[model samples]
Target: MESNLINKDEEVIRRSKTEIVLKLLEYLKPYKLKSFIVILLMIIVMICGIINPLLLEIAIDNYVVNKNVEGLMIIGAALVIINLIAWILSKIRWTMITSVTNNILVNIRHQLYSHIQTLSFDFFDSRPVGKILARVVGDVNALKNLFSQSIQSFIPQLLNLVCVAVIMFILNFKLALACTILLPILGIAMFYIEIHSRRRWEVYRNKRSNLNGFTHEDFSGIKVVQGFAREKETEKNFKAMVKELGDAFIKAVKLNDFFWPLVELSWGAGTLVVFFVGYKLITNNEIKIGTLIAFLMYVGMFWRPIMNLSNFYNTLITNFSAADRIFDILDVKPVIKNSKNAKNIGKIHGTVEFKNVSFSYDDNTEVLKNVSFKVNKGERIALVGPTGAGKSTIISLLSRFYDPTSGEILIDGKNIKYVDLESLRSQMGIMLQDTFLFSTTIMENIRYGRLDASDEEVIAAAKAVNAHDFIMKLEKGYHTEVNERGSRLSLGQRQLVSFARALLANPRILILDEATSNIDTETEKLVQSGIEKLLYSRTSFVVAHRLSTIRDCDKIMVIDNGRIAELGNHDELIRKKGIYYDLYMTQYKFLNE
Candidate 1:
């Protein structure tokens, strides 16, 4: 699946740079007034910069040459005032840009997370959790400088460049032409550098994402690693991944580093040409000493913005891949979203029917093949099957996690696909094999089943599931906080808490997919009593390996190879001595031994 996902990523149509820039600019629409203000301040700062060299020329030629101390002092004071104003404006612009950039990032992250939640289970099944997190956290963050710096540096530097060029031309056209003669060569160098650097940065981003995926998977299964004493092996693998990432970074940086030096070289060569030409002009009396000095200052100002622009361009290329990745997720229309005319199904009567349902995660293999089943208002069904035998796929289909590739699923006579997803899911409760709990007080964890449930209701549900005794025995009772995934709790305890949470929801339909596999026989019996009471009048589905637990269910389904091999009540199936009978007899004999 990881390899398939990587292939799909590689095949993604890369958006043009202009498209990305245009999309980024769309984020600024909401802050138009603030952006305008920022731009206005930048222009003011650039104007101040352009005036400084002229003031220097006045002080040098009109005051110093004439020995006019008072005039020189006035020009000196004006330069200070202009620079001080520019500094103040620059600081304000920085603050505004930072705030705007942060808000845009927040909006983007929120949208990405919300869209991910709406995607089909297949989307998650194909990708690692760490890779998704990388897009949400790392990729989104990479765009931070692109937003802030584009405004902070790009705009101001561009305006300063144009203004300085105009001032230099006004002072002396011949020298101005000499100062800019190397720009064409610089542009050509940058063009080649950008072409190479962009590809390297894209490679670097992919390597970083791979590292993130491995790190997340490694830590998630850290206990398993230690249990098998594979810590050293994992450490070796981790170092290899880190080295790969480091190598990719070095390759990218080697190319990116060329931008600055190339700009510097152009600046140095341009300054020398200006000096040579200005000397010739001075000797011919075509330009005054003050004018030549002012022209030199303008030349420095001119190249400074070019260097700044180059840095901004470098930032754009480096992070544009991240921007493309972010947009890729945003561009994916959720495969499991509500239809335009879909409406709420309101409260359902727990009648579920899968008519000739079939599904496949990909194009090649079908997980469920034309399997049909029906559960009346209050019938309890037990599904018994081997691993990967489509038992879980049946439940997932009923929940509408993924729509069938063929046929239709109806709940209370309405097609589930036409109903509002939230309304459809609200009436059903599911508990899976791998139980998970949030890092919070046990009381809060139970209350998550029904957010508005009272403390009394939460406690009652916990008591019903036989979890209250173990919970109360803790140091802080129900208020005790658990670690991530409730790692601090025993497996049986976690399953019990999950069971209680499901019970608290008061769902009309309940699913228990190996919900009691972790509990011992003694606890299972105790929990079974509560389960019997809770199962009264509520339609429930149980998938368990323990035949004893399903012996009394209304019906037992033996699913094999994506098809139902046997379906009957315990006594009825036992009389026929079929698949259910064989399974039950084997487990029954094992338990006796």
Candidate 2:
């Protein structure tokens, strides 16, 4: 949607991320031993590289000028030795840098991912997946460049360039100054380009992330799109983003389009000036022709390093941009992390109460309007309502998915907010409308309900839910892989497995959300009995589309537009002939047939 794209705010275009860079450098302090070795190799590589131009001079002036054939052979042998030394040092440097960079990148990725898991649910609630992933993949890659690979390559070549500059100045100051004018001007030009291009590149990265987000969302909900037959519409929307992304990419390239060429052309002009200056100096017998030739060799030798620097100059900034993204995530203070004096969770007794609870997602019209209720241990409470009647919101409140805007939800006698989240959640089991199963074995998926549950316990849970028979029919039986998001199983089978998972949890509070909606009537009867066994000693909240699923509950509360309209047993509610009686008569009259 056009509404979802960035607002084109220049404020979001940040300066080069330097602080996080320093922080990343600080993170690398633990690896000081490896970094010290890397730096040592860099010095050796630079020193060896700087020797080549000097060798070219000796080959020309010391041997050829003397016209001594023996001298020529000696100089030529020494040049070969120099080249061999340089080659060996360069290989060692390359190997060290590559290995260190890969390892450092690996460490950073794991650390960042782990940090993300520690964040509370609200942080994920507000951000788009595309934007978040941009940080994880794009920004982390940038940090890899700035931290490890960039330092090694830039340092060695940079040291080599400086050494060559010193050599040129020593041989001929006038010629060297003429050659060196390009350096300052090129540096100034690069600075301007980097500043301007960073925003463009940041935008480019953001756009790319947006594309990733769209692709992720579209693919994740392909079934919904197919069901609605809106594939063409989705394609059209996707194409629009692709076109915008193309435009943004081209703009990024255009921002520094002249950078490389200008550097090269300026280098060319400087070299030509050097040639002319050297010729004039030679005419006056102020410098040897050999010296001038060697200086020319040095100038050409260092041009690549300088130009490559232009790219890294911009890259260093992009890496910072990545750090900025990562820090943005890290900076998010968790809404529900453990407090300073947070204590471990104790056992739950499952007495839940909502005292005048009212909630609004933000400062607007309220969703839950001072609704209140209570449930004792071992009670089966059915929450029945039309869509958006706040049944799920009430369950979400009970689960602490979102804190109430006003008033309190208490568990037993303790405030639910004060109760440790892990303990509160551990005591509750929730099966959602759309079941979630990971890409692992069926047994493992069920075992996730209670990680320490034995294989025998898992099998028992599956049998209770009537899923073990179907699972055993598979070729791999309990060990059969579910594939990503349970793509390997039918919807009904996934629901059955989810039921088994909840059964294995054996929680003190159970929330069954359409537990048997997709299953056939025969299986629903079996699962309903299994659910009864699971809920026998626990407080249970049942949200069901089929009235039959809730007929056996201890009490049924019919919610209408966020207010409880009626509360009674199935027979009593029918006899009262209220909203429940009308809905039950309309939606479930087939049972009487």
Best by lDDT: 1
Q: Whose TM-score is greatest here?
A: 1
Model 2 backbone overlap count? 0
Q: Write the per-residue lDDT of candidate 1 for residues 1-593, one digit (tens) a residue.
A: 23324212332346899999999999889988998899999999889988988999989989999999999989989999999999999999989999999999999999899999888777787787888898999999999999888877877788788888888888889999999999999999999988988888787777777778878888999989999999999888788878978998999999899999999999999999999999999999998999999988898899999998999999999998899888888887778989899999988788888899988988999988899888898999999988899999898988888889999999888999999999989989999989999999999999999999999999999999888999999999999998889998988889889888988998998998888898887778778877886788889999999888888899888899888888989899999998888888998899889
List TM-scores for all candidates, in order. Answer: 0.96, 0.88
CA displacement after TM-score superposition, residue 276 of candidate 2 (Å): 1.6
- The TM-score, computed over Cα atoms with residue i paired to residue i, of candidate 1 is 0.96
Error (Å) of candidate 1 at residue 387 is 2.6
Which lDDT tens digits does candidate 2 get at residues 1-593? 11244223112324345665566776666667877777777777666667767776877778787787887787678778877876787687667767777787788778778888777666677556665676788777877667654657566667767877888788778988988877777788777877777777767666777777778778888989999999999898789878878998799878677787878988898899899888999999998878888888877866767877766665675555566666666665666665566555578878888999998776876778888888888899998878888888899888888888999998886787776778778878998988999999999999999999999999999998789899999989999999989999988899989988998988888998876678887777667777777788889999987887888898998888877888888999999999988988888667777
How many clashes in each structure?
Answer: 0, 0
Local distance difference test values of all predictions, in order = 0.88, 0.79
lDDT at 80, model 2: 83
